[model samples]
Target: MILTGMIFQFNKDSGEGLIMSSKGATNEFSASNWIDTSCEPSVGLKVSFEGSDTLINIEVLKDESISIVSDNKKYSASDEQKMEEFSSVDEYIEHFKSLGYKLAKDTDDGKVRTASLRRFLEDGHGEMIITSIDSKITVKTMVNGKEVK
Candidate 1:
């Protein structure tokens, strides 16, 4: 789920903080939960994030307008994209699962199927979600929080 909030309080030394959501709920967060660590967060900074109950993704909001403060290459979701053909949906899932990714979500209709898998790579981490219509499948990948085509 996505939630918008401002930093309620942060202890930079300990890398821990609380986010005060618009709904008046406060949730604890950690620096380690940040996907884009280029800009260290400060108290009172408005942020929108998505994550499970324990983890948070601040980039889905940061990338929309806020300029990142990193000196490293700007992470664009579309950079270095590639396309590959898969013989079947099972083939696609097996390919990524074999590489140590775990299935995150899977759904199917009579005519279409979809699945998402994720892995924390040693050098770069990524999520792969594939959708299949009949025998044709399209795969989308996000590496180090940037999407690849």
Candidate 2:
């Protein structure tokens, strides 16, 4: 059984991530101490806590909070093939997913085109704005209200 946890930093150097299994801090968090070899954990991912129940440091779980650790992840790459895949509207929808965006909701405002990601912002505060289609190979990131071209 492959263990799965929210992967933070992929230590290609060590071939592991700082996994926070169900048995958290009670177990040492050292690289040699990573207990599971499941799917590589993606930062900011909320997955199952797939270890046993036991915590070492009473407040140590705080260190394993994936979200808090993910806050510092400055960037991620999108699929180049999915950028300009607007051959059809359905393809356009799939393009969104390919670009690391989720299909939150689909509603017909009685229109031919869909208003993708009504509230698409990287953290709700608009810290990043990904304005690109599946057919384009370029991704422009907007940070602090400025476009980083």
Q: Give the alpha carbon lDDT tens digit for every residue of 1-149 in model 2.
A: 12223333345565444433321211222344433355333333323333344311222223345443342322333333225624555565565554444443344443333333211222211112233344332334433344544
Residues forming the 10-long window of minimal summed lDDT in candidate 1:
68-77
- Which parts of model 2 are misplaced by more than 4 Å? 1-62, 67-74, 77-82, 117-149
In TM-score terms, candidate 2 sits at: 0.29
lDDT of residue 33 for candidate 2: 43
Top candidate by lDDT: 1
Which whole-number lDDT from 0 to 100 does residue 120 have in model 1? 39
**TM-score of every model versus the real structure:** 0.43, 0.29
Candidate 1 residue-wise lDDT, 1-149, digit = tens = 66555564689999898765433345789888777665777765667677546647863345443343222233333332433466887787877776555676799988889998755322244568899886788888877556765
Model 1 regions lying over 4 Å from their true place: 1-84
